[model samples]
Target chain A: MSGTWINLLIDIIISLSLLTGTFFIFSASIGMLRFPDIYIRLHAVTKGSTLGIAGIMIGAFLFLYVEHGIVSGKLILGMIFVMVTSPISGHMISRAGYHNGVKLWDKSVRDDYAEAVKEKRKSIDN
Target chain B: MNLQIVINIIIALMWMFLSESYTFSTFLVGYLLGILLLFVLQRFIPDSFYMDRVIKVIKLIILFIKELTLSNIEIVKLVYKPKLDFEPGIFALPTELKSNWEITILANLISLTPGTLSIAVSEDNSKIYIHAIDIPDVVESINDIKETFEKAIMEVTR
Candidate 1:
């Protein structure tokens, strides 16, 4: 009887985490569609997706731990890998976008890089 | 680095005994077990900067998680709004951290956050070029990165 109660508790926890994870992921996709530019959109994709995936992984991990009593190191390692890699990929894309001269939004308040480049060019020409 | 790897492997082998299994699973168990054991052993093992660095790396991971969450919320709000009105710009941030690995980690951390994306590293590696969605004030943004990420990184590696 007590085992059943404990299982029910685990089920509820898992469901709650799953729901929350799904919501974050939903928010991420929505953000991707709505954001104005590549850099900003990249932000939405990386941070939201990382945390959303984290939530799902945590839920799955908890369920596995409670149900099987087997602490799967693979799941934890997978989570760590995801957490580490997403940012690196995001960095690569954003850097490439910038290097390719992807135009910033019209309302973008600053262009420090452009100004810096021009200054270097002037100094070299002199 | 050599000592750390050696300790990690021994811990992994010990894990094989505890779990009563010897396979790839032992390696995984060893890695985790090494972390836990090193964490405890650090207190007794005088001058063991090896475990200290591992612990610091773990702290960095925790810090990254907290910042990641905050940035996610910020991005979500911006997305949910009717119009995106952030002040975006690419600026150069001077970094004191020298190592290639340290610089890479710093860049990744910035890119992972909501508003900032690392664009380039200067030829001299003295500055990291970042494109941020909101840079209303240059000094404020620079200080934020220095205080939160760079400071912790300096403690860990440099």
Candidate 2:
């Protein structure tokens, strides 16, 4: 009897986690399509998808722990790797975008890098 | 190589033997148990620099999780809104973190958080240039970074 109750509880948790994960990933997709510029789209994917993947992994881990009583080293390691690497790739992409002269949106208010780039260019031309 | 890794491996082996199962599950449990044992032991050893750093890193991880959830909701709202109301800008924030690893961690944390990206460092390596999606007040955002991530990072690095 208690076993059945525990099984039901685990089922609820797994579904909830999976649903939340899917929602976040969906939001990331919408954001990628809707955002105005490359940088903003980058932000959407970096945060939304990372958290979405985390949610999915958490659900899988919990399901395994509850049902099979087996913890997965690979899942844990994969989560750690994703968390560590996503931001790095995001940083590199944005840095490259900036250096390649991608313009900010018209609504952008300030850009200190523009002045810095001009200063460097002036020095090189002199 | 390091004492910590060596100690963890020893503990993991002990777990494998004790469980009579040299499987991945045993190793995972053993690794976690080893961490807990090391955490407890580090308190007694005066030379243990790792325990405090580990605790601070865990704290920072919690902070990042909380911030990520909040920012994810914020971005969702922004994405679905009829019109985006953002004051996007690029600003330079001077950082006190001196080490390359520390700066890298800080930059990564900023890039992972809400509506902000760490674009580059100054030539002098003293300032981090950030692209902010919404900057109603630049000083306020800078202070927010300093108070949360910079301070949390300093706790781990120093």
Candidate 3:
């Protein structure tokens, strides 16, 4: 917060991966937009966005450390947690949606899970 | 539970640091805020309930690594075979575990290992059909896969 605005601008400009990181975030956003099914979208939302956002936030955080000397530990720590939890949470939500009887898109191939469960139950009951 | 998640975040921070990108303030704030936010969000998102999520995850990773190492060796041996070492096909492996988390871990572990792909898991979470690179002794391989991975999932998630 203490650095001059121009100095901060220079610091932000210099970090190359920050741009790359932004690019990943863009791809993730596009993936979310383009994917047809909730399941497919969940994959993007979880894996792509999680990694993308983590990269961007971490890149931005790196900029702060070099420029402002703020060396903000809290934000970096938050990024790590987000990286870990986001995918797990995302996967869980998708799984729940599947289990709670949300149907997959019609064009999707392989409903093996449904048949497997049905046969398993038939065997168990018999 | 919140406290545990916070601890998990702290542990994660140590990992990030090892990767050597440290915004000391960002790390601190992110750890606390991320855990807090995740816990708040957990309430609204409905999912298969997992009481032993952390343990289950750890167990899954360990089991997957073991399977990967073993399968890598298997792949190596098959590579040298003179007469096409495998007749690959898909088979359904019976699974009793119903938890979505556990089933996914099972599928992922299968997919992660060499020579196997978890093509499908039953919606009711009973059987998983996997395609093996070498469909040798379907029952035995299925058992090995289950014992190596699914059992661990059941033990932890149960």
Candidate 3 local lDDT, A1-126, one digit each (tens): 656887767665656657655655565566566554555445444444444555567777777877578788876787667654654465456557655777766544344456655676799899
Per-prediction DockQ comes to 0.62, 0.67, 0.04
- TM of each candidate vs. truth: 0.78, 0.82, 0.44
Show the colliding residue pairs in model 1: B12-B30
Candidate 3 lDDT, tens digit per residue, B1-158? 55556554775586567657777775776665655555666665355323347657776666654654454344434433455434454567788777777776666665545555555555556777664554565446567756767667776766
The residue pairs in collision within model 2 are none
Docking class of 3: incorrect
lDDT of 2 by residue, B1-158 (tens): 16777888899999999989979999999988988888777766445736567778899998877877877887787788889878888888888888889889888878767778888887777988888888875457668667678888887776
Q: Write candidate 1's Cα lDDT for A1-126 as tens digits.
A: 999998999899899988878888999899888877887788788888877887798898998899889788887788788889988887778768866878887878776677665666788899
Instruction: Name the better of 1 and 2 by lDDT.
Output: 2
Worst 10 residues of 3 chain A by lDDT: A43-52
Highest TM-score, which number?
2
lDDT of 2 at B16: 95
Where does model 3 exceed 4 Å of error? Answer: A1-14, A119-126, B1-158
Evaluate model 2: give its TM-score.
0.82
Q: Write the per-residue lDDT of candidate 1 for residues B84-126, one digit (tens) a residue.
A: 6678877788888888988998888777665777877776778
